[model samples]
Target chain A: MPKVTYRQHDGSEETLEVRAGTSLMLGALTGGVEGIEAECGGSCMCATCHVYVDEAWLDKLPKVQVLEDEMLDDTASERKPNSRLSCQIEMSDALDGIVVELPESQI
Target chain B: MATDEAAGLVVIGGSHAGHQVAIAARAAGFEGPVTVLSDERELPYQRPPLSKAYLMGKQPREALLFRPAAFYEEQGIDLRLGVSATAIDRAAHTVTCDNGTVLSYRKLVIATGTRVRPLTVPGSDLVGVHYIRTLADIDAMLAELDRVKSVVVIGGGFIGLEGAAALKTMGRDVAVVELADRLMTRGVGKTVSTFYADHHRSQGVDVRLSTGVERLEGENGQVTGVILSGGETLPADMVIVGIGVLPNQEIAEEAGVDCANGIIVDENTQTSDPDILAVGDCAQFEGRFYDGSLRLESVQNATDQARTAGATVSGEKKPYDSAPWFWSDQFDLKLQMTGITVGYDTEVIRGDVAAGEFSVFYFKGDTWLGTDTVNQPANHIASRRLLDAGYALSQAEAADEGLALKELVKAARKGG
Candidate 1:
């Protein structure tokens, strides 16, 4: 299992051990990290799983696609250069010890 | 509640609302622990199927479940199914479960949603009297369908009517009884409802309107017949009730949140307590801003409200302003509706109702209020767009059945 560290807005951290071949959204889910809702399951119909890939590990994940890009643009959170839908990011050994930041709002 | 980094989030339900809240919390950049408490053992699921696709047995369990196991694991969500929140402590911000475990949270989302309103008349607890709400209900209904050749549905609402239609298509002697004056009286206009009722009766369903059921009569603890309010008795081996639902807002009310018919929230889905939010059929918001001060019941409302709620959890204060929409599938017919049709003074029936491809367009004065389309997805799609875009329709163009909606609206515009 790879360890994923989630950095909170107020300078705190909650780490979860995630198995490879899972999504960052799932890692956050089973690990009990806060603030990822994934409303439409993983259908990409809803953008509740929005997250920001840590600046350092941004290149390690797959590129965001057109649908995800479209959804991210609709997210209430301001899209940053590092914004990504966590559901689409499959965890892997290459992404071990990665970090993702949460936006101030999701509505 | 203080913004303590150690305070975890605990969502007490596991379907549309619960799943969305967890994901949206993470999306909004919250940094703490998150846990989903669910009673059902199955993974979180899309529930629209329980009445349609799942009832027909065409959709598998995987098709209805939310996401795969790995999605939860990788998202770092602690999904504790087979668990339920038994009580709440507002001061401590903790939820006590039946298993004697207590989970603490900085903020809480009460997404308990709703349970199907049960039939409350005499013999309601009989073996053959059923209410179609959950997967278990459908499974029980499907099993009984094979042993019986006739069914008398006790309600004429959407679920009761759809169940009657589905069983009728299966070649059973199906009968529908409604206390209302027409089928889907709460949904469509009188004209459209009449047309649909005529169609159902023509298809061999005993469509009984203005009828109220008194009790389910039985022999040896099983259903045998129904006694109506008019003192008329009808024979049947099975009965399905679709009386509608009540919002599951007791928990929110007890937790000190403002709860009316549902958990009262604003357009942003924010409850009065600030620390709690409600969504789905369990939520009630501002009144008469669109319709006659009403709350809605549908899948579109659930998913859309979930999005708005999720966004709120993400820390944004966006109001839920998306136009409401809903769909229902019947035997060889698809009914799509948009907006609130309560205040329409004039309705123009486009195309031929006899041919079954027309739409009922409702307008209040000059503005388009809403529309109901039967078997015309394209027309419904166009109507939803035009209604949502705030386009007005002239009485002449709206009354003219020969003119296409596009051309009619274009010609009736201010400049034209």
Candidate 2:
């Protein structure tokens, strides 16, 4: 199990051991974590499961493709450099221990 | 003002909502540096037909592009593609970008839209599983439609049911497993859902209600079937999950704005902060439609609310008032809806439900809340005007098989 940490705006962090190959979204949902709503599952159709990767982990994840980029622009929260739709990010062994910032808002 | 002046307008997000906001801004004579930041690399496209028309090949992908690529250039919009807003420093009035670029703005419009829900159960990671929320999703499904012999749709809501119907029309075996008791329970009333379930069944769809999919069963890195909660097995070569959507308002929350089911806004779509506004599926506006509540997911809602937010940002305070409307088409059947019918006590009909052509009106205390017109465009159109006007109807007039809807609305307007 890979440990995933979510940092909310209040400077508190919730860490969960996400099963391998689980989309970071399901990991959060299954861990009973708050903030990330994997609405629409991870279809890139809805941007509800939005999160911001710590700048350090941005390079570790898969590159944001055209479709994912397209949907991110539509997010209601203020778009940012670290912003990512958590549904598109899958948990892998390489990300054994990673930290992501919870979106301050999830519409 | 020319491009040199930088229209002083910042629109972050470019789809149905953002584009409309930009166009409305230009229409309102704000001639400064009108910048539109679009994260979608494929230009501005609408997602309305991703499940039906586009899947059926009745509409081209380019047709779905909200506006021509040239329209942005001609309008002198600094429409940046493949770029996203990284952060909003409201105190500094700047929008930071991923590429180390920061845009200074006098005002900003955040029309970030919604996404399709992803399937979360085990084996959802398998290949050939898709969501009908974007053009890419449709492209993959349409390409696989020819090869896939069967499909398992996880939800029987409008998107799931419509996509299942379309796939089934292509001669594929489709199993629509819905957690809800009926189809489109949120959009239309229960009676109308029954009519659609029967309609879908008569058309050869396996309509499974009150059934929940526990997991996707896969083999060889591909979807094989879905396991039901009751230990039933559904064979399938592919799966399309259309559970629903949630608003993308993460950035707003971090900035300390109020959000409930969605970002909380007033009738004008203004959030807790006066500087920021919310719209589209990501927004929860305190609105009333018919005798029930309101918060729609159709493109109509996106554009309507976008227009209101755009105008307001431009210093025009207009109360947002647009009759909620939506449409979903399947196999020669067009299901159009007007207003929302959440808590209607009486549902009246004016056509034949069995014949696959009829209109069901939900009314509470003699006032219409909403109408679902299946294959009856005229009735749907009239229902929109009547419902928007808060027109009244008697029990006899509402269900009169011989009554003309146009005449009915006129009569209701006369205080009859």
Candidate 3:
């Protein structure tokens, strides 16, 4: 199991131990974390699950796909270099302690 | 500054799009009260999973809701479940509910969505014949799952293929009967259609192409088989119809809204009347994705239009100019498509189609039209950006397999 931490914009954080092979969005959603809308239900069609990956873990995660990047442009918040759609990031044993910060709103 | 009155913004139909309209109105600083009317008993839920996870019993009922009932209350939205807007009083700016409640609204959003197009044939109303639309329909079908050994799915559209895949996964014998020559004929090109048909057939689904279901054959008020146009009987204890859907536009039409195939709306999702707006599947508007007017039945269109409509009602006018995108999952293949492919002059295939990771890019003369990618999310995303930015790719450049599509999109953006 990979333990991921989801930090909110209001300086609150919640960590969960999610099974490998599931997505970060699924982990946050299954764990009842606020701010990740995920309206498309992990289909990569909606950009509601926008998050800012911790700078240290940015290069450690998989490369951002073009699809996820396009969706990031449509995020409610301004897109940053570290902004990623959490739904596109699949959890694995190697990435056990990754941290993601949620945006203010995922409209 | 003048204070805005506490007027009501009533949204008809509490599906995914309807819920968004209500939520967006509040999010966009609409000081008016928001009311959402739904005919279904449950709160706003994701309907896409109904044919797949929910039907397979893998997804629980609670997992279907887009947001909890508490979320609506927290947002100060008046969520009315199990009640429908029967009539729209355009002149009075009020809506009459089926429960005899008349609510006046300052702005009305019609997001009635669509209903499954019924199969009107002999024995169509037999007990085991089912249509997958709402959660109730899926639950009813699940109740008869154990008794059904074989299922004959009518249509080769997305819902039909998805339902067939789910049934096959559940160890049931399934067959997809399509009237068109290929699967997803109207949506995708011939290459994609054939690829999907072959893929579904490889997954143990009997893909019957160019076959019309003349009528259903039932015994003792229970469906037993489906009769083909050539009089061949396919033994099926269960029947799932995914032919298509018709927009629920009757209520809007009665209110004297301009409706052709669907309620015609402008770029802001505003209908013939400025106070009246339409979103989701029932709303037809001129979009940049296609040449003229188009009504998309996907969640992307629903969400996008809802945001625009909500913003417009709240005094922020944003045009619905975004390129349309859609995705469908069947068996193990995840297809992501963007833009419209109806009038492509040339087709370019990139990646290995046999390996199940390929994208077909369509172009008209020198302009990029759209793309359909199977298990190629990167290509789908890049194509959408290019289309949205009005970046055209020449036939020569799009056909080159060595050039990365993302890089091309980046270059197009820089050059444009």
- Which runs of model 3 end up more than 4 angstroms from their true locations? A1-5, A12-34, A53-85, A88-99, A104-107, B1-6
Candidate 1 residues B1-416, lDDT tens each? 33323567777788777876787677667567878888878788777667666777655555466666777777678888889888777888787877888777777777788888888888888888888776668878888878888789988888887788778877889899989898887788877889889888889999889989888899999989989999998898988888888988877777787777888888777788776777777888764327534567776577666667666766776567666666666677767777788767888788789997778888778766778888765556556545545666566666676666655334444444
Q: Model 2's CAPRI class? A: incorrect
Docking class of 1: incorrect
**Tens digits of lDDT, candidate 1, A18-99:** 8787777767765656666565445443567788888899888888875577567556677888999887888899999999
lDDT, each prediction: 0.75, 0.77, 0.87
- Best model per DockQ: 3
How would you encode candidate 3's per-residue C-alpha lDDT over B311-411 as one tens digit per residue? Answer: 99999988888878888888778888888888887888988888888999887777778999998787787788788788767777778888777887778
Off by over 4 Å in 1: A1-107, B1-6, B287-289, B400-416
The C-alpha stretches of model 2 lying farther than 4 A from their native spots are A1-107, B1-7, B290-294, B411-416
User: Isolated chain A: TM-score per model?
Assistant: 0.93, 0.95, 0.96
lDDT leaderboard ranking: 3, 2, 1
True contacts kept of 2: 0.00
Ordered from best to worst TM-score, the candidate numbers read 3, 1, 2
The candidate maximizing TM-score is: 3
Model 1 fnat value: 0.06
In candidate 2, position B252 carries an lDDT of 73
